[model samples]
Target: MSRPESGAPTTTPPPTPPGESPAAPLPAAGPGPGAVAVPPSPCLSKVELRVSCRALLDRDALSKSDPCVMLLMQSRGQWVEVERTEVIKRNLHPVFSKVFTIDYYFEEVQKLRFEVFDINSSSVPCGPREDDFLGAAECTLGQIVSHKKITKPLVLKHGKHAGKSTITIIAEELSGNNNYVELFFSARKLDDKDLFSKSDPFLEIHKLDDDDTFQLVHRSEVIKNNLNPVWAPFTISINSLCSCNYDRLIKDQPGVALWDRGASLGRDVPHADEDLASGPVDGCG
Candidate 1:
């Protein structure tokens, strides 16, 4: 066929056959090559990060270092600890079950730091702890969720060179299944730390918030003189517990000393100095 006097636009479809309605032009094709590839959708989401460490150097003399991992996020040019995993006693390679939930903003570069500490004595729940420092790793939350799982070598503060310590992380977006958990927690033979009477032990349940603060969700009654006590069952929202995320961890810590609140016998009463009548616990429960 002779070339048309004018070239028709190549992008336009061929004219439809007569008596046939032109098929609706194919929906606009997706961006072609060199067309600035559309960046991913703005990632405003809730994600749970699970962490683990391997090949950690033992900081203890007698046994392996009791290691726990703390996760800190960069906030206003400063890194603040958001959450930490439970201490794994005498284990060089610890797979922490603690899941750190956080809000992911793709627009901003969200920096993160994972620090490993040999928690010999101090057992603070969250960051800025006074414990033996092991090593750390730094990365952006975007890096983690992008790869889904990543492994990075551990280093000292300020990215100082360190040994074979390394950490692995896995990221997962949260689901919308909101549920509550009914848990009955108890302590068996708690340590005694009293001068005059049995230790008064109670439980303080805490929830980690988006602002990186552990807010006290509930407090159990103080059970006096009972070392192994069964606390009443409690109901906590799964969302409150861990934002309804899967595979969350439950942590336990030693309760602080609460002096025995009991009646002191008068001098006339020949009662031993240790004889402390536990005060009425009617209101305690």
Candidate 2:
């Protein structure tokens, strides 16, 4: 991970109110008690999103979690399931290959939530509602579009569990193309700023914007007590990294008190001609 650039501060947009929903009218109530209500037809300008989960909590009694993700849209303060992924058996880290298409109204804030469930194979004959709750993550379409790609840690409280998970989201506009890049980084002989003679270091990657300001694009986890730290590899879209401009000013910073001190760092930029399996580029400070 790289350190965020020290450029003009970016303000986060206010989040949509908790109880508010889209202006579209809800479907009529079900005729019988305990009947499920149908979802309203989605409106214009749809966008497709890819979702994946990492480090999900296992909820099965005798085996690892058979996780499935549910995509929901907020309507009238209630969540309506718009799409769901197939159950991935016994995997804590699951990449849902299904792409979800939802209405994208630039004028309105579309609140979205992703719920993870541990599916019991036996319950498959019944319905998805019978799956065990695992965890959930929530965000708005505006927030996702603004960032291009967002990775957030999932919380289990929303699903009534006490556990953690992570969700990676990539948004592809209906009319735009998608490009991806993989990156790996490491630092060596970093100055120790802490009293214990070791530094807690991380990385933030920022992309220079049109206004000559840097916007944070990716952040790495903090590595403790190690001058030589190699962060986990991550994949991000080229557009989100620098709007697809190879010459754009890409800034990498170390997240530590001694960042000002000379620390040797390495950066590996992916090449278009090379396979995604290629190794990271090493840099020396």
Candidate maximizing lDDT: 1
Candidate 1 least-lDDT 10 residues: 264-273
lDDT of 2 at 72: 91
Residue pairs in candidate 2 whose N, alpha carbon or C atoms collide under 3 angstroms: 1-203, 2-203, 2-204, 3-204, 3-253, 266-283, 268-281
Q: What is the per-residue lDDT of model 2 for residues 1-285, given as tens digits with 9 covering 90 to 100?
A: 754457533344455578986343333433567777786664556566767778888777776777788899999999999889766566787665456777788778789998888777465667655347677889999898778678887876534533557888877565443678787877667656556456656665555556554454555555656667777888866656665666662343211221221222222111111111112324412
After TM-score superposition, the amount by which residue 162's alpha carbon in candidate 1 deviates from its true location, in angstroms, is: 2.8
Ten consecutive residues with minimal summed lDDT in candidate 2?
Answer: 268-277
Against the hidden true structure, what lDDT does model 1 obtain?
0.65
lDDT of each: 0.65, 0.63
1-285 in candidate 1: lDDT tens per residue? 665345332344679999998864343456666788767878588887878788898888887777788899999999998888766666787766456889999798999999898875534445335447889899999999998779999888677655888899877666676576676666655556566766556555545544554443444555666766666886765654565644443332212222222332121111111222222222121
